[model samples]
Target: MRQGLIRLHCGVIEIENVSKRRGRVTVLDGVSFVARPGRVTGFIGPNGAGKSSTLRILLGLDHAQEGRALVDGSPFTALRRPLTCVGAVLDGSGAHRSRTGRAHLRWVAASNGLSRRRVEEVIELAGLESAAGKHVRGYSLGMGRRLGLAAALLGDPGVLVLDEPFNGLDAGGVRWVRDLVRTRARAGGTVLLSSHLMSELAEIVDDVVVISGGRIAARGTLDDVTGGHGSLEDAYFALTSS
Candidate 1:
């Protein structure tokens, strides 16, 4: 496994007063938070609390009706060779079912002008070598998640925006993700992990942002936000209940 040089250009993510609406439903209302470089920031919220919507806006997959999401002070869409700057895994698989894992990654690498060597490197990093030749449709949910993670690392990105990255993983896989996120942050990369599992977030995140009803309920370092609540899970329940 080749540990690449630390890229110094990774930037902080700033989401300011962003609001979004889907038809008549307001999915996000004044949602704001920051994922600083060299830290794992946890974005926690219940289902329908707009976590996914907020991530979509940040990735430039969807536009907000108000406010803005910026990466290193610029919109994601404006960046040249965006993948080299930020890597994202918004959902499951992110690949066609008929394609083998290797083929799926090869296409992404080709599109980004990344070398086959880089793809192989990420395959090893993601522990997907054994299953690399299998079609995605035959993969278990855990395998698919690993494949998505492999794709995300293909760019050796400075910033990682992963939504529910731990989903479908067994104990070993979960530990792998936890260590990987920590390693990335320690190397000066920014990581924003959105998940509903408070226990998992507590184990990895340096900062926590809690959302409820499309609004920011709390934001700060884990200790600051937990604030005598005993645990992140408790703090989250208390904050969202209010």
Candidate 2:
């Protein structure tokens, strides 16, 4: 909701007239939004709003029947070493149950051609030092989420995309993630995070893209979209219900 120039490290992320379908159901329809660097772009809507489907296409996890999702003016498939360019926490469960926390990170680091030293650095950053040696299966939901974030940050990517990152977070975890996102934005990383709960998003996001029934319902700065109203919650209710 904060207003300022959009900084760029990886340029901008643009989703234009994108649509998706599964069998007889259409999951997304002409959905579009732009994510600028140095800002937290919140993708929000009620359940079944196509938030996840949109993110899936953006990450190249799924294909859109129409339209395009571009990063730095290029599709995700066009990027070399996509993971290095874009850190993602799409699933907060982390890695395999058989692997230890440290092992999981090491594998990810190795696959990305990153240094082993980075494994420890991300562990500390995610506050998982104590549990780093334990098997991932024993970790709590919050711990798993932290581990997922550590993996995402392993590359110090120019862009970060997180889906429902606050799903299993504790109050402390939520606060940590909020500040972490702002800090990452200030550090010049493009961030696109999704949450169904608009109230939680209003606290951290600078811009918002709301979707409903797989279509874009609203898009703009927090103040502009909300009309400097009482809160994003009020604006969200009006937009979605109307």
Per-model TM-score, in order, reads 0.96, 0.93
Clashing pairs in 2: 1-206, 1-222
Please provide, for model 1 over 106-213, each residue's C-alpha lDDT reduced to its tens digit, 9 standing for 90 to 100: 999888889999999999998998999999999999999999989988888889999999899999999999999999899888999999989899989999999999
- Give Cα-based local distance difference scores for all models: 0.91, 0.87
Name the Cα RMSD for model 2. 3.7
Residue 86's lDDT in candidate 1: 89
TM-score of 1: 0.96
Estimate candidate 2's alpha-carbon lDDT, on a 0 to 1 scale: 0.87
Model 1 stretches with alpha carbons more than 4 Å out: 1-6
Q: How would you encode candidate 2's per-residue C-alpha lDDT over 1-242 as one tens digit per residue?
A: 11233334464789999999998899999998899988899998888989989998998999999999999889988977666778889867559999999999998888878988999999999999999999999999999999999998888787889999999999999998998899988877788999989778987888999888888989998887788557898888777775
For model 2, the superposed segments whose C-alpha errors exceed 4 Å read 1-7
